[model samples]
Target: MASNKSAFVDDKGKPLRIADSAMPKPGADDIVVRNHAVAINTIDPAQADGFLIKQYPTVLGHDLAGEVFDVGSNVKRFKKGDRVIGHARQFLTGQPEDGAFSLYSRVPAGNAAILPDRFEYKQGVVLPLAIDTAACGFYEEGYMQLELPSLDAKPNGRVVVVYGGSSSVGIAAIQLAVNAGYRVIATSSSKNSNLCREAGASEVFDYKAESIAGDIAKAVGDDQFVGLFNAIGIPESFDVVNPIMEKLNGGFLANTKPPGKLPSFIDAKFVLCIGDFGFPVWENFITKALESGKLKCLPEPKVVGKGLDSLQEAFEVRNGEVSAQKVVVEL
Candidate 1:
C-alpha cells in the first residue's frame, strides 16, 4: 500500500497541517488518484468553517489532476496509471479519505475526467470544480437546464451573458455555454478580454468600464438571451447583470452564490455545484474536446508553490486576490 501525505484540518476554523497517513482505500465506485497537482476553490474556507465537513480531522479540497493510483472493480472507465482531473468531493461527501489536498485522493469515478496529454497537471487542475460550477449554472435542471453539448453539437441561436468571464467558473461557463450552442457574451477586465474570447465567447466586454451594464445591454440590443449566469455571484454582479436582463424584460439568472434580492421580473436560482449530476459532461465531452482542441484549460494555471506542505499558504493565496490566472500547487 502507498503512504499518503495529506493536508488535514483537524477541526473547523483551524489551520491546515501536513501529515503522514495511510493512503485511501477505494469504495466500490471510487477511483484513487495520486495527485500531481491540486487547485483550491472559494468553497475551501466554508469547508474549514464547518459548513460541509462531516467530522473532525477532516480534509478539504475540490480540485486535482493526477494519475490513477487504484480503482474499484466497479469502475470500468479507468485503471491504475491513467491521467485524470477530478473534482474532489470530500467537503460535499464529508469523507476525509477522499480529499484532494493530499498525495493520494479517492474521488468518485463520476466526478472525474480523463486529462489530455497536451495539458500539464497544473493547467488541468483548475478546471474540475470550476467546470462543475459552470455546468450547474447551465446544465442543471434546477438552474438553466438549457441543453447538453455533444461531439457534433450545433449552435442553438440562444445567448448567455456570463458576467465576470475572467474568473474560473466564468471561463468554464463561457466555454461550456458555447459548446452547448449558446452565443456567449462575456465580461472581463480589458487585460483578460482575450482569454474570454479564446474560451469561445462570441463577444467580450470590460467589466471595469463606467457603463458595463449598459455596454452589455447595448451590445446585445434586441437579441434575447436564454439566461445570464453570475459567475462572481456577488450582489454587485447581480446589480450589473440585472439591467441586461431587464432589457429583454425577462429570462434566467443563475448565481454561484446564495440567492439574494433580485429584480421582480427576473427568474433566478442559486446553485451549489457539488454533485454527481455533472458527471456525464466530464465523462462524455471533456476528453474528446480536449483531444480535438475544442476545450483548452483556462484562464491558465499560476503555480503558487510545491507539495502538500504548501497548501495552507496556497489556500490563503486563493482566498485572497487572484486575477485571470487560477492558483495551483504542484504535488
Candidate 2:
C-alpha cells in the first residue's frame, strides 16, 4: 500500500496544506498512480468557494501526469510502471481520496490515457480536464453532438467558432473539432493566436478588437457554421457569441457554465462534463493524436512551485486571469 501525503483542504474555502491522508484503495477497474506533476484549474478554486464538499480534509488536485504504481484485478489496459495522465474525479464524484494532489492518486482506468515517452509530465498534464470539458461541449447528444472525431479525415466544410481559444478547453476544442473534420475559427489574444492556429484553427480573431464580431461574420459568411463553443463561461462573452450566432442564423451554443437565457432562435445548452464519457476519446485517439502531432500540449504549463506544498499558491493563481497558460505544480 502507498502511504500518502496530499495537499489537503480542511474545509470548503480553506487553504490547502500538505497532510497525511489514507491510502486510496483501487476498485476492480481502477489504478493507483504516483503523480509526478499536477496542474491547477479555475474550477478547483470555484469548488473551494462552493458548497460541494461532503467531507473535510479532502484532497483537491485536478489534472495529473504520473506512473501506475498498482492496478486492480480487472484493470487490463495498464501495467505497473507505465506513464499515464488522467483527470481526477473528486469534484465530479465528490470523493476526497479521488483527487490527484498526493504522491499517489486512485483513478479509474477509463479516465486515464497513456502518454507518449517523447512528452514529459508537464506537457501532457494539461489535457485531462480540458479534453473532458471540450468533449462534453462537443459530443454530448444534448450539446453540439457533432460526429465523433476520426483520425483519417479531411475538412468537411463545416465550421465552428471557439470563443477564448487559448484557454485549456479552447485549445482542446480546436484540436477535437478539427479532428472531427470541421474548420475552426477561434478567438484569442493576439499574443497567443499562433497557439490556436497550431491546434488547427484556420482563422483566429482577436477577442479584444472592436470589430471582432464583424471579423467573424465575414469569415463565416454563409459557410456551414454549426455554432459557438464558449470555453470562457463569463457573461460578457455572450455578447461576442450572440452576434456571431445571429450572423450564422441560429446554430448551437454550448458552454462550460450553467445554461443561461439565449435567443430563442439558437440552441443553447450548458455542458457539465461527466468524467465517464471522456474515456472513449482518451482510449480511441488522444494518445495517437499526440504522437502524430494532431493534438497538442497546450495553454503550456506555468509552474507555480515545486512539491505538494505549492498547491495553495497554485490554486490562488488560478483565481486571476491566466490566458493561454495552465498553472502547474511539479512534484
Candidate 3:
C-alpha cells in the first residue's frame, strides 16, 4: 500500500503536483478507506480558485467511494473490506487533514456510510455532498422533520419547482420531493431534460428558452407550486423564478448566498449545507438515508483518468464541462 499520495494546488490557484506523503493512522473514532473513486463537485474548483480557500496545498476532493481498510478501535459501524462513501468535512475547523484526492483517507465514523451492494464505486461517489445538500433542504437542521403543514394535508397535488434541475443537488431534490409525493417541475437546458424526467420531475422546462419562467408558470397553472428549490445560486436564477414564487403558498429553498431582504408571500430560506459541525441531527439523517437507500445515488461518475497524475487535467475538465453527470477520479 502506498503510504501517501495527494493532488495539491499550487500558489497560482492551479493544480500543480500529485505527490507522495505519509498515510494517516486511524484515530479511535475514525476509519481509513482505500479509495476506489473520488467524486468532484463545484466546491472543488471554488476551493482551488480560493473561493473557500483555507490553506495552501490543501487536498481537493470531498466525495469518495472506497473500502474500509482499517478502523479505529472505537469504530463499530464498519469492518475491513466494507465498501463505503466518505462524507466531506462540512466545516474545515482547524484540521489539515488530506481530503479524498489521496489513495487512503481517514474519516470520522459518523461521516462514512456503507455503500449498497447494488452500487459500484463510481455510482456511489457523487452522493455524499449532494444528498447532504438535499437532506438539508428537506429536513430541519439535519433531522427528518416532515412536519410541513402542506405535507400533512390531503392530496392537494402541490407543485415544487427546482431550478437547475440537471445539477446534482437538483437531481437529489427532485427525487426527494417525488418520493415524498410532491409534483415536481424543474428547469434545465434542453439537453438535460431527459435526466430531469428520469429523476421523477413531472415537468421539465428548458431554462435556455427565452420564456423559461413563463413556460414553467404555464405548465404549473400560474403559481400552483407550493415550494421552489433553487439549486443554482446565480442571481438570474432568482430573477427568473421570482414571479412564480409569488404564487406559491410556502417558502423557497436556496443554495446560494443568503439574501439580505426577504421576499414577500414566499419565505426565502438560504441553505448552506456545510460549516455547521455542531449539528448532529443532520449527520444522523444523512447516514440513515444513505444506508436505507431512500436517497438513490447518482449514475456512475465519468472518470477523467486514472491516478493522481491526471489531477490537473481532471480539474480543467471539471471547470469547463457542464454535464449533468458527476466527474470522478480513480485512485
The candidates, ranked best first by TM-score, are 2, 1, 3
* Deviation from truth (RMSD, Å), model 1: 1.5
Clashes of each: 0, 0, 1
Taking the tens digit of each residue's C-alpha lDDT, what string does model 1 give over 1-331?
5788888899878888888967888999889999999988878867777785678888888899999999998999898999999988786667778788989998999888899888999999999998888888777776788677666779877788998899999998888878888789998889898999999998898876777767777776666568888898887776667767776676888888886877798888887778766888888999999888788889788898999878888778888889998888999
Model 3, C-alpha of 320: deviation from truth (Å): 0.7
Runs in model 3 deviating more than 4 A are: 10-14, 142-158, 209-226, 257-262, 275-295
Per-residue lDDT of model 2, residues 1-331, tens digit only:
4588888778767777788878888899999999999999877887776657767767777789999988999998899999999988887666767998898889888888889999999889999988989998887777787777768878788889999899899999998999989999999989999999998899999998878888898898777888799988788988777877786777788888875888887788887755566678888888888888878888789999989988888888988778888999998
lDDT for each of the candidates? 0.85, 0.85, 0.70
Per-residue lDDT of candidate 3, residues 31-65 (tens digit) = 88888888878777777787666667667677877
In candidate 2 the C-alpha lDDT for residue 259 amounts to 57
* Cα distance off (Å), candidate 3, residue 158: 4.4
- Residue 324 error for model 3, in Å? 1.3
Name the regions of candidate 2 deviating beyond 4 angstroms. Answer: none
Candidate 1 local Cα displacement, residue 200, angstroms: 0.7
RMSD of each: 1.5, 1.5, 4.2
